[model samples]
Target: MSPPPEHRRAPPPTDAETLCRTGRKVIATEAGAVAALASRIDAGFVAACQTMLACRGRVVVTGMGKSGHIAGKIAATLASTGTPAFFVHPGEASHGDLGMITREDVVLALSHSGESVEILTILPLLKRLGVPLIAMTGQPASTLARQADAHLHTGVAEEACPLGLAPTSSTTAALAMGDALAVALLEARGFTEEDFAFSHPGGSLGRRLLVRVRDIMHTGAEIPWVPEHALVLDAVLEMTAKNLGMTAIVDAGQRVLGIFTDGDLRRLLEKAGDIHAVPVAAAMTRTCTRVTADRLAAETVRIMEGKRINALLVVDAAGRLIGALNMHDLLRAGVL
Candidate 1:
């Protein structure tokens, strides 16, 4: 009387498997959508970059709902990458914020459907103000794209949502396209690391790219040094007084002959044989790690970590000792 096994209901998947499968599907779907965009980039993308590069005023970015969030991030990336830009809310634009935009600027609008009522409301005014409008939309034939000076297609064939309603794959495509646009403009403008640091002065990149070794190094009398002929006890006294944990043993020309550190003292103490009577030149390390004053202070981190040492002697082009810095100096300067 029972039905065949094939006709019966199959066992449900385990909860863990269900969750993993769903997560993987979303990621694979979105990844494929982004990958597909590489072939779609064409003349419109170029026109957008050209318009952005030549803009006399800021790039005004706007969108509605989920697209607005993407638009704000796009504006930020463009601004930080040497493109002048900021975001304006489309609803706010319909109010009085439209005054923030001017004829000299370029407006980049985002709308997956190309028919966001809030965005469409201001199209005529933007046109009247003579602002160049660049549209990033999923639908190429829609109003926003049709009216735009240049249209970038950010379409995705499928949404990662099970219901096919969420703005998942679409938003990812839009964000990737915005990044492409920013990078294109960055290349066209010849934006440099120093230029990026200006926008991010409070970030680590600014400290690394903008700070020079001379700015934080102990220069002049602060440089700890002893004559090459000085005894171990004399060099140890110099190191203790200067508190740099080391001293440069220099010649009459102030050229560094060698360096003696607390580590070397420790090694000598282990031997327990006339350690203090040894000449610093004999006990010191002849090959000292040195940097130039023009070098980036941030570079000290790599050198110290790679060489397993904490101090550096800075020399001039003429090979004369000019300055010195330690890990402590880098820490104080916020370069570590």
Candidate 2:
């Protein structure tokens, strides 16, 4: 199956020291390229941001080859950080996908050479639509850069590739510029943690911010509790039945008066031995922390961890017990 010896030749034996030096050289070169992009974020960068911010429609990001990968990531970051954006391949744009572009949309085109044939092919169409164009390219004098409303120069002294052919430093610079643009737009719109969580609803930050205590707390019969005058034995039975490792001591009207925990039970057994006759209220912690049903579960975790407690009782505005939750509940709900 092998056609040519030149194409089938194997690589030389590895040199660990040379490989390490090469890795460091690549990282240093890429870092320098990214750092250089910061200085170029002047008027053109501001103009690009202004254009995107003024657009009523989404940002349409287009690129070819290696630039396309960076464009997709930039699009995702933009979309998640409050700027609506999506990626469109330059090649596909020439094949009827150009219809996706509209005057309402802001076009962000990425091409190191600034003369991608596919992108240049649709440049006229974009102009015809009167859409604002923001070109990210290495060549300031290239056609794409000259025709755009704003040009972000991503030029580097040299690529990290020793052969000076592959897109190592150029892609790094482009990615850094993309991140800077996304963050600038995010701040301009005053995007908050809650807003970010809304876009990442499946992530841990979403769970912590959006999940309320009431959503995960045990309710009705599932909540472990014993009457204020109930025997310690009864409280132990309730804790075992609920498996919450603790039980609330409440009055007949369901107002939480105190809490009896596994730790309290252990301490009581060591001190008074026979809890078979002891009142639950006498053995309960009178200063136990309780929260309202509507509080955030994340807030409850902080309270529990700070106070060195495991369980908490949930009450209404009138101080009547309505629900209960422990560390285990929060953990299960991904709020831990």
lDDT of 2 at 58: 93
lDDT against the true structure, each candidate: 0.93, 0.94
The Cα error of candidate 1 at residue 142, in Å, is 0.6
> Can you write out model 2's per-residue Cα lDDT over 20-110, one digit (the tens) per residue?
9889999999999998987898999999999999999999999999999999999999999999999999998888888888789999999
lDDT (10s digit) by residue, model 1, range 194-299: 8999999888779988888999999888888999889999998989888898999999999999899999898888876676678888889999899999998877
Clashes of each: 0, 0
| Location of the lowest summed lDDT over 10 successive residues in candidate 2 | 5-14
Error of 1 at 105 (Å): 0.5
Task: Please give the distance, in angstroms, between residue 129's alpha carbon in candidate 2 and its true position after superposition.
Answer: 0.4
Top of the candidates by TM-score: 2
What are the clashing pairs of model 2?
A: none
User: Given candidate 1, what's the lDDT at residue 104?
Assistant: 92
Q: Against the hidden reference, what TM-scores do the models get?
A: 0.91, 0.94
